[model samples]
Target chain A: MEALLYNLTYGFSVALTLENIFYCFSGVFLGTLIGVLPGVGSLATVAMLLPLTFALPPVSAIIMLAGIYYGSEYGGSTTSILVNLPGEGSSVVTCIEGHPMARQGRAGHALAIAAIGSFFAGCVCTLVVAIFGPLLASVALQFGAPEYFSLMVMALTCASVVGGGSVLKSLAMVTLGLLVGIVGTDVNSGIWRFAFDLWTLADGISVAVVAMGVFGLTEIIKNLGDDEIPPTLLQKKITGLMPRWKDLKQAFAPILRGTAIGACFGPLPGLGGTASSFASYMVEKKVAKDPSRFGNGAIEGVAGPESANNACSQTTFIPMLTLGIPNSGTMALMLSALTIHGIAPGPQVMTSHPDLFWGLIASMWIGNAMLLILNLPLVGVWVRLLKVPYRLLFPVIITMMGIGIYSLNSDPADVFLMAFFGFTGYVVVKCRCSLPPMILGLVLGPLMEENLRRALLISRGDPTVFFTRPISLGFMIATAVLLLMFLAPVYRRARKVAPAEEEG
Target chain B: MRLKIKSTEDFWAGLIFFGIGLYAIYLAWDYPMGSALRMGPGYFPTSLGAILSAFGLAIIALSFRLELENPAHVPWAFRPWLVLCGTLVVYGLMMRFELGFVPSLMTLIIGCSLAHRDVHLLETALLSVFLTAACVGVFIYGLGLPFRLFWWSY
Candidate 1:
């Protein structure tokens, strides 16, 4: 505890430097801005900004990026509440209750609660990181290929089962994603496996490119058609931005519940931001007095899920940094960035580069503080954007997107690719097929495959080694249990309870 | 009104994906995939591709089942896909010409407007120019990107 406290004090001393604080604020503000504007994801923004960080010390650079990350997760909810559109896909669940609360004239309350919950979740997660990061790293050092393979299997099962729909569809999408992930050249052999002869395919698809194209670009294409939504939409004055005492009282329980749940679930493999929200919401409903108020703008509904989402987003790093494995799409992008800088994330990263790992964890707290100050007063400025004409809005958004993407490699092809993905993304959304699983599949597949094959190599091609080891066996059992839990009749009956209606 | 989802779109799409996956898996069969003894690289890819194809077929069956049960849920669209596609083409063509960010985006925006009959040419041009200048200034200049100030600067 003393060492942990000293580390945090050291962390704060480093983070409080004016230069670092400035970068933290810059990252958070920029993150929130992207979060408010749809089609410009933090992942793409971070990837594009990566080159700029090449000159900075690893600590400052990582701090700013982490700020952007946590900021966007919270910032996306702001738009989700005010406008039904989720700035980032991770906040899709936020729109369920968030927008409803807005429609019911509780927009201020929803926004305030989201920010507070985010702040609380971020703080709790920061403490968790301070305490557990070192411990987790020590444990992870013992992990070999078999353990990794089992972890991947468990993640795959969790992703499939928690995909929020029929297990069959989820499995299909996951598998398809995995196959697409294999399109690049084989690392062990000098042969290409699934490259369709395209040079780009040989390198495989960039997750940022695919995600930005499919999710971000796709969303713009959609708004192009449905731009006008009953022009008579209510424009709330949004009064003061502070939460009412009553609302805060209501928000308290949810925040605690959410933090506990978030801390527990955040470190798990395969549980992304989206699943974290679902699990929180489900648990909240089971614990709440009036379950029916859930979809109808319940305050706790806003608080719990938002907190859980942030916790999962932050703690996911525990695995990625300690194990060199990413549990979600966003982290995969981060890992990709780290790899470019000659860092393979995992247990060794902590020992080899304590400054980088701890700096990032410590920076998260500073980033959250930066986000709170950046977002609270600036709430007025963001809401004012609602009044902008769609035509004007589109051009500015397109420009920012163009500049961000083009800057990636000075490759104009990426620009066109983004636009193409945008159109295709819209089509997918129109089809009611969720892109989360696809993104998850794309991000996790290659990592899973890499680990699986490595484990197999160690075991001399014996596939059963995944179950033979005690740790691997436990993970495999957990995965099977998760699958069984999801597929059970009881789970299905509960999920089928009611349908939500969308506001125009 | 939401467009009625195609009666067979889901199943067909799944089948197509399945076929592609299978074909890739077949090609990977010859890649000397590392086995347990040597850890050949192509082994995981081949196996994953095979699994994908198998799952794809299963998805197609499930999709077919859903379609048969709920005919109304065949995917529907609100906007003409042509406009979105046209905008993308404009982006590519302008990019090929090495048009600077502003001019290329202007043309692309105008072209996208052309998709709907209700376009105002003057209005689109104005908005596009405004957007281009801001983008060039904020994202490029302000952010200090190495963007070419002129289209032909190599």
Candidate 2:
């Protein structure tokens, strides 16, 4: 109780500052703008703004950037619904039902539900973090090399098993990502493992480069061949812009359920937005009065997954801050930004910098409220954005991808890398392989290698250290349970029904 | 047209992955990794590599024994393959030619666009030129990297 009050007071004091408030609003606003644009992403937007943040105090900079991260997820749904393209990978699921809702003349309802659900989830989860953060941080303190290795293994396996495509293909991509991660220099020995002799390659690949290539540019290259027209508006009526009472009743349950599931899954690695969304949808289907409404633009579908996506985005910060492990691409960038400021992210972060933690926590609530205002009136404005011709839009996307990649290091080589990966990702998509595992593998690979090396060093060549550690042993057990689910016939049936249920 | 695999290609692909995994296991040999904080570096990779190789073998057997397929796939799509692989090859070689950003990117765009013959030459060239300019202005100039606008040393 005392902690709760302290957090509330601490957060309010930190979040209400004139500068933090202004930047928070600015980040979310820019975040939403980019989010509404189909090919542009807030990652690139924030990355572009990072150089500017160098002059600001570290806490304010982090607060604003974090605001952008969540705000983008919230606003990215606008594009997904109005246009079929997602602003980011996480919102891809929203497109299936969201666009359907838009086409059904409920675009207003769709946008409203997403905005409201995201705000509610964001606020609720912020409170959860305020209450549970210290306990979770304490738990993270016990992790060592073997424990870290097991955690990454679990995340990798979970990502593969839940990926819902050919598990073989997913595994192949994971292996490929690990190899790509090894491209840069090896840190321990200071020896370059696979730089391929290019000086640029010595630093290996940037997440911004990989993300723009895979999600941003590759999308353009792939869509250039498909001749589908952008979606047409179904109605001009703003009546029932707010959800109907019945719709609200339907959404409330899923929003709560989504929040619960998200709080648990969000902290787990590799399960960030995509997994939380998947988990939310599956649970909604499992308990639905009429599960048949699922793919047919069920309002529940819109609420549950959107809420989960936002919640998971917030919780993923846990790993980055508590354990110094970045669970997602956005978190990885955040980790680097902090490191750039010479403020290492670990358990010590909270103890050593309470103001930063409390301020960030408080700003999340403020940011969400700002987002509600930002998204609510602009629903129509965002809708009009979909009307922009692809010829014009794709060029802008291409430009943003270029400029965003350049902003990271001002390297033309990085742009070249983006263009190259864009081509491969297009093929990978055509081949029906999932790229989520690839992203996971890239982020986890280096840490996996380092932990493996460290573990070996500690054991003096003993193989039993992995199994002997209690925490690692538990993660290994979890992995085993996950594999069993993969093998189960019930799980196979769920996968079949899952896609079909989503076909509407 | 969608092509269906007769499971033969699956077997060979799985076989290749399995073989590579086996090689990785072989590579992990002789590194005496203690605990992570201690000595050797190769222990975990060796064990994991062995497991991965076994998983690869299981996939091979599963492919041979059972069939699972998706409707969206063409057993082989030459258009996408040609464009993807062909562009990558050009990008790889462009470094050797010491091409400037504009020339290398335009050439890459032209080459990749040509793979899709449905696109007209004029349209493809314009798009390529447009993309090249975007790259120059945004990545090279906007980021302010100390790169030459042209490739020549002079």
Candidate 3:
């Protein structure tokens, strides 16, 4: 207990430096700005800003990037409440009750409750990370090559199953990503595997380039293609920024439940804020005395899901920080950022760079606090930003993306590569394939292969060694169970449908 | 009897993956595949390629078994896609030839803005200038990145 406090104090000391604080504030500010925009997402924004962080110290860079992440959650709800259009996927649940609140002239109350709930959740989950992170890292330290490989397999399986879409397609995307990931020179031997004689291919494709293409460029292309009428902004003036005492009391329980639900789901692979928020919404509905009050401007509905979403976003970092396994594309981007700074993330990150680890936790609390301040009094500023036409905004985004890619290695080829990926991403999305699994595969592929080889070499080519080891065997079983759990439903559904088709 | 594809999206997606997987396997075949113990450079890739091909085949099979409800009719944004990609390619080529940041950035902004159906030339030109100035000020003056602002020997 005393040691944790001392470590926390040390963390605060590192995070309190003016330089780090400035970066943290900037990160949240940019995160909120892009989050409020309907077309842009936190993933694309992070990918676009990654090159800018190359010059900063690793601690400051990650602090800012982390701030952008949770800050976007807070911003996403604002749009959900105001426009009835979800700015981010996790905030879609907020629209169920938040928009009705706006329609009933309680936008201020809904927004205030959301911000407070998110703030409370953020603080609690920050503590959760502080306490649980080191413990998880310690456990991860015991993992051998076979265990790690099995764990990766389990993570990949979970990612594909929960990634939303056909399981078979998601798995294929993962394989494609793995192939793309191994496009450079082999580490074991000096031979070039998939370089295709291009000097640029020797270094492999940059994750930023892939992210820019798949997330950033693909987003713009998607927005352009979407011909749906733009959602009208709520014209009513928002008043009563503070929630009443009764309202706060009503929201308090939901917030607590949401935080608990979010913390539980967040650390799991592929189940992030969106799942937790939906789960919180269901729980709140079930627990409510008047279930019909939901979807009718229920403050509990607004509070619970928003808090759950924020908490989930915060906890998703656990797997990344502790195990060096990214459950989602956003985490993959964060991992790549750390890799770029020459910091290999995993169990050693805590012991080797204690300041980066603890300081980031401390800074998250500060960033959450900063978000509350930014979202509450300065909410009006973001509303005006919504009026910026997509045409004018898209050009600027394109310019930024182009410049961001070009600045990476001062090679325009990277920009072209981003374009190629953008087109590929568009086609991939058109085919109803999820991008997250592919991204996870891309990031984890090489690591998985390295562990597989090491594990095999240690066992003298004995493949059964994986099943013989207790931890590895457990992971393999877990993977099998997870795959079975997903496939069973699909198999049942297909059988039912096939019989009906034959009858027809 | 004609074998009809139940899910058109899945069929195309499966074909793409299957093609890529086969290509990956073909490429990895040339590399020396050592034994499982002291694996050569080709071992992992060859295995991954085979696994990918299997996945691709599975997906192709699924496309025939599963039926899609309201198969999404995605209107391909050919113009936006082409213009945005062209803007990047053009910007890259210009930078490669030392066309300077200003011209390349202008081309990018102006070219991408054209992707929209309702483009005002005057407004787009202004946006291009304003954005180019902002980029130069922020990226060059603020961050001190190494970029030539114009085609001039400084």
Candidate 4:
């Protein structure tokens, strides 16, 4: 406890610096701006701004980048409230009640509740990190290759299950992602696996290129292809930024429940903020005295999912901070950012660079506070952003994406790769395949393979080592349980259908 | 009379996965597959290829069971596709030739305007100049990238 307080004090000293504060403010400001704009998400915005961070101190750079994340979460909820369009996947749940509330001219109430709930969740999660992060780091210090491999397997399985599509299709996407991940040179053999003689392919496809393509360009193309222009924002005047006392009372419990659920799920690999929000929404619906009110401007609906999403965003840093594992595509990008700054994230990050670790925690809290202050007063300004049409905005976005990819390594090949993935991503979207599993698979694949090889090397090629070790065995059991939970219903339904077919 | 593909998504998705899996297996065929105790690079790829093909087969099987809500048609928007691709290719070619940022950006904006139904030449031209100035200001002057504003600087 003393050590945590001492480390956190040191972190505050670093984060409280004038320059660091400036970076945090700027990052959140820009993050909120892009997040409020439909068709552009925080992931794309972060990818675009990644190059600018190359010039700053690593601590400031990471702090600013992280601020972009939470700031965008806040802004994403704003868009969900004012417009039916979700700024990102997690915010999709928020739009159910949030947009309905907007249509009913209670937009201000929904926006205020979202901000309040998110701020509360953010504060609690920061405390959770301060207390539990160090403990988890100590636990991670005991992990070896077998345990790591089992953990990745469990994460991948859980990720695929929660992805909410055909389980087979999600697994296929995961496999494709793993294959894509393997396109770079083989680390052990010094042989290129799938480079196909191109020097650019030798280094493998970059995360930024894939993310921008899948999320940004693909989204624009999909929007353009759709026959319908997006519905315009509710024209009613937003009244009463502060909710009634009774409404706040109703929301308080759901907010707390959401934060708890999100914090629990956040540290798990593969299952991220999106899953947590969805889970929280379900819980809120089930627990509400009147469950039917969920989709019809229920304050609890907006409050619960928004809080859960924010809490999940904060707690996700736990695994990344302690174990050097990313829980989602966005976290993968943050991990890449840390690697670019020459800081390897894992157990050693805390012991080796205490200030960077604690400073990041402190900066997040400050950024959340800034977002709350900025969101309420400037809600009107962000709503006006909805008036901007798709045609004018899309061209600018493409230009930015082009320039961003080029700036990464001054390689036009990256741009071409991005365009290729963009088209492919559009096709994948049309086919109803989820992108998250593929992304998670892509990020986790090489790491899992590296660990599997190391484990095998240590066990002298004993495949049974994973089953033999206690931690690895535990993780494998969890994976089995998750798979059965997800697949059991399908099996039951298939059996019933078979009987019906025979009788017919 | 014929075995028809019931689900277009599954058919295409399965085909793509199966093709990629086969290609992976073929690529890794020559790599040494050492014993599991001393695994070679080929071992993992081969295993993954087999697993992927299994997934493909599973999906393809499901295509027979699952019915489509509507017979799938090509989801392509030809004009947007052509204009977007053309603009990107032109921008890339210009960058490859070391054309000035202004000209390249103008080409991109003008080309992209064709994707929309209502194209105002005056508005597009104005948007081009504005966007070019903004890009130069932010990317070049603000971020201080190494790219020269004008090609003639060489």
Candidate 5:
């Protein structure tokens, strides 16, 4: 306890620096700006903004990137409430009750509640990270090659099975991603595996390039192809930014429930804010005195999912920070950012760079407070931003993407590579293959292979070494269970019916 | 009697995966595959390739399963697809040839705007100038990134 407090105080000292604070503010502010705009997501925005952070200190760079992440959650809920358009996947539930509330001239109330709930969740989850992150990191430090390899397998399995898609297709995408990861020169053998003789292929395809192509460029193409017109903004002047005392009282319990749910799900691999928010919505509806009020303008609907979404976003950093494994595509981008800054992600990050770990946690709280201040009184400003037409917005977004990728290495090939992946991404989506598993595979593929080789080398060709090691065996069992659950007939039926249920 | 393929999406997806997997296996065949204890570079890729092919075959088999409804086939949006991808390729060429940053950016914005049906010439022109200026300010001046603004600047 003393060490944690001392470290937290040291974190505050680092985060409170004027420069770090300014970057944090800018990150959340920009996060919200892009988040409010329809058709643009945090993943694309972070991928685009990544190059701009190259000049900063690693700590500040990560701090700003992290702010962009959670800040977008707060921003996504705003659009969901007012326009009934979900800015991010996690906010899709907010539209259920939030839009109806807006139609009733309570847009201000819905927005305020969302901001407040997110703020509350952010505070709790920050504490969750500060406490659990160190413990997890310490445990991870003991993992050897076999354990790490097993853990990667478990993560990849969870990502494929729980990622909500045709498991076969998702697994294929993972295999393709692994192949893509193997394109660069092999580290151990000094042999080029799949470079196809291109100088650019010698160094593997940049994860940023893949992210921008898949997330940013692919999104723009999708929005352009979409035939539906953008949703009209609520024209009424929003008044009464604060909810009544009664409404707050009703929301209080849901918020706490949401925080608990989110805190548990966030640290797990393959599950993220979208799942947590949906789970919270279900739980809130089940617990409500009147279940019919859920799809109507229920206060608990907005409070629970919003809080859960924010909490999930905050705790996602735990796995990435401690284990150096990213659970989501956004987290993958964050890990890549750390790598670019010459910081190796893993258990060692905490012991070696205490300031980066704890300072990031402290800064998240500050960023959330900043978001509340920015979101409430300035709700009108965000609404105005929504009026910007998709036509004008997409062009600017693409231009920035081109410039961002180009600036990364000043190589035109990177931009072209991004374009190739953009087309591939579109095809992948059309085929109903989930992109997250592929991305996870891409990032972890090289690491998994490296560890597998090391473990095998240590065991002198004995494949049983994986089963003999207790930690490795535990992970293997978990992987088996996950795969079994995926393959179960009941689960397969549920997966098929899930889309139709969501539509209804 | 013609065999009816149930899910077109799954069929195509499986074919692509199968093709890629076979290619991976064929490519890795030449590399030295050492013993399990001291595995060579080829070992991982060869195994992944074989596993992927198996998955591909499984998906193809599953596509034959009875699906209740015929999924709606949305036609590919080829116009936007072509124009947007063309814009990126052109931008790459411009950068490759050292065509000035402003011109390259102008091409990108204008070309991308053309992807949509309703394109107002004035709005696009003004947006191009404004965005280029902003990019210059943010990427070049603000971040101190090295870039040639115009062909002459080179």
Candidate 6:
């Protein structure tokens, strides 16, 4: 505890520098801005802004990016409450209760509770990361190739089961992503595997290009094809931005429950913010005396899920910072950011880069505090931003995307590659195939293959070695358990099936 | 006329997966596939390709098992597909030719805005100018990216 305090103080000393603070504020402010916009999401925004970070110091860049990450969580709920359109995947739950609250004269109430709950959850989860990050890193130090590979397997399977789509489609998407991930020159051998004689393909596809293409460009196409203009649900006046005392009292238990759920799920390999929020919503509905009030304007509905999502988003850093493995696409993008800075994330990150680790944790607290200040009083400004039509906004977005892609390597081929992914993303979405599993596969497949190969080589090609190792065996058992858990529900209620649906 | 499948989603999804999987397998076939103890560059890719093709086959089988009486309509929006993709192709070509930033950016904005009929020419032109200025300010002036605004030398 004493060491943690001392480390945090050192972290604050670094993060409190005027330049770093400015970047953090700018990140959260920009994050909230995009979160208010309908089509833009946290992942796409981070990908788009990644080029700018290359100019700053790595520490400042990461702090700013992390700020934008959780700050977007605050801004995401704003659109969901004001308009029925969720700015991102995790905010979809917020839309269920938040939009209803807006339809009534309780928009301010919903917004206020979301902000407060998020702030509370963010603080708690930041602490969780600070406490668990080092411990998890130590545990990860014991991980061999077999253990890491098994962990990745568990993550992919759990994500697929909870991914809430056709299991076959998700699996196919994952496999396709793995293929795409390996398209560059094989690292082991100097042979080009899937380059098709193109020089650029030898370097592999940029993660930013993939993200902007899939999330940003595909969203634009979908919105353009959508002829109907979404009616603003904020027809009622927001009387007050502060919730009543009774409402706060009613929200307290739900917020605590959400924080617990988020903290638990956030560090897991497969489950992330969206899954935690969905799980918290289920818990809230189950515990509530009037379960029927869930889909409506229940304050508890907004409080629990909003807090849960924020908690989950913060906890996502644990695995990324400790294990150097990403559970979600957003975390994968962050891992890419760390890599671009020539900092390999894993157990070594904590010991080798103490300033980076502690400073990031400290900056999260400051960033969350900054977000609460920006989100509450300035909620009206974000609501006004929603008035910009899709036509005017989309052109600017596409232009920025083009510019962002060009800035990466000055290769226009990257721009074309992004467009290709955009088309692919649209096609897959149309088919009701989840892109998260595919993205997870794309990000982790190469790493998994490397570990599996190493594990096999070490064990002299004994496939049974995976089952023989204790940690690896445990991970495989966990994966099997998760599979059975997801399947048993379907088997039990064959006729009435309600799978959890998520988009990342 | 295009071929209409009974299960449009499953059929198209399956076909795409199968095609990609088969192509991946073909590409990895020639590479050395050593034993698991001494894995070659091709070993992992070949196995993944095989698994992908198997998944593809299973999905196609599922299409038949879950066949619908009234087939799902395939709303393949070709106009957006052409215009959206064409914008990037044009932009890429312009960038390759060193046409500079502003012109290429204008092409992207103007070209993609045309995909949807609702865009006003005047408004789009205004947005392009505003965005170009913003990009030059933030990306060029602020971030100091070494990109010429107009390629004045040309």
Each model's iRMS: 3.1, 5.0, 1.0, 1.9, 1.1, 1.4
Best by DockQ: 3
Report the lDDT tens digits of candidate 3 across residue range A224-339: 89884466776546787887999999999999999999999888887767778878998999999999998899999999989998898888899999999988888998998999
Assign candidate 5 its CAPRI class.
Answer: medium
Better of 1 and 3 by DockQ: 3
lDDT of 2 by residue, A93-121 (tens): 78867888877778788888888888899
Which candidate, 2 or 5, would have the higher DockQ against the true structure?
5
**Relative to the true structure, how large is the alpha-carbon lDDT of every model?**
0.69, 0.69, 0.85, 0.80, 0.85, 0.82
Share of native C-alpha contacts between chains A and B (below 8 angstroms) recovered by candidate 5: 0.70
Tens digits of per-residue lDDT for model 5 on A1-504?
998889889999999999999999999998888777775666766766777677789999999999888777777788889898876667788999999999888888888888889999999999999999999999999999999999988887787777666777877888888888888898888898888889998998889999888878777777777775677766469986977898799999999999999999898776777778888999999999999877879989999999998998899899899999887778888998898899998999999998899889999999999999998999888888888888888897788789988988999999899889888888877776777777778888888898999999999999998999999999999999998988798988876653311100
Q: In candidate 3, how many Å is residue B47 off?
A: 1.3
Model 3 alpha-carbon drift over 4 Å, by segment: A490-504
The C-alpha RMSD in Å for every predicted model, in order, reads 4.5, 5.4, 3.7, 4.5, 2.1, 2.8
Candidate 1 lDDT, A180-299, residue by residue in tens: 677788676656667667665677766666766765555556656554552222455775478789999998999888877777877665456666676688888899998999899888
lDDT of 3 at A460: 99
Instruction: Decide which is better by lDDT, 1 or 6.
Output: 6
Runs in model 5 with CA error above 4 Å? A497-504, B1-3, B66-72
Model 5 chain A, poorest ten-residue lDDT window?
Answer: A495-504
Off by over 4 Å in 4: A235-237, A242-246, A290-294, A490-504, B1-4, B67-74
Candidate 6 — which residues are off by over 4 angstroms? Answer: A233-239, A291-293, A486-501, B1-6, B67-74
lDDT of 4 by residue, B96-141 (tens): 6778777878888888777876677887788889998999999889
User: How do the residues B8-28 of candidate 2 rate in per-residue lDDT, one tens digit apiece?
Assistant: 545555665577567666654
Distance from true location, Cα of A59 in model 3, Å: 0.5
Q: Residue A269: error of model 6 in Å?
A: 3.8
Query: What's the TM-score of every candidate structure?
Result: 0.86, 0.79, 0.97, 0.92, 0.97, 0.94
Off by over 4 Å in 2: A4-26, A37-65, A83-104, A225-229, A236-250, A270-301, A326-345, A352-356, A499-504, B1-57, B74-154
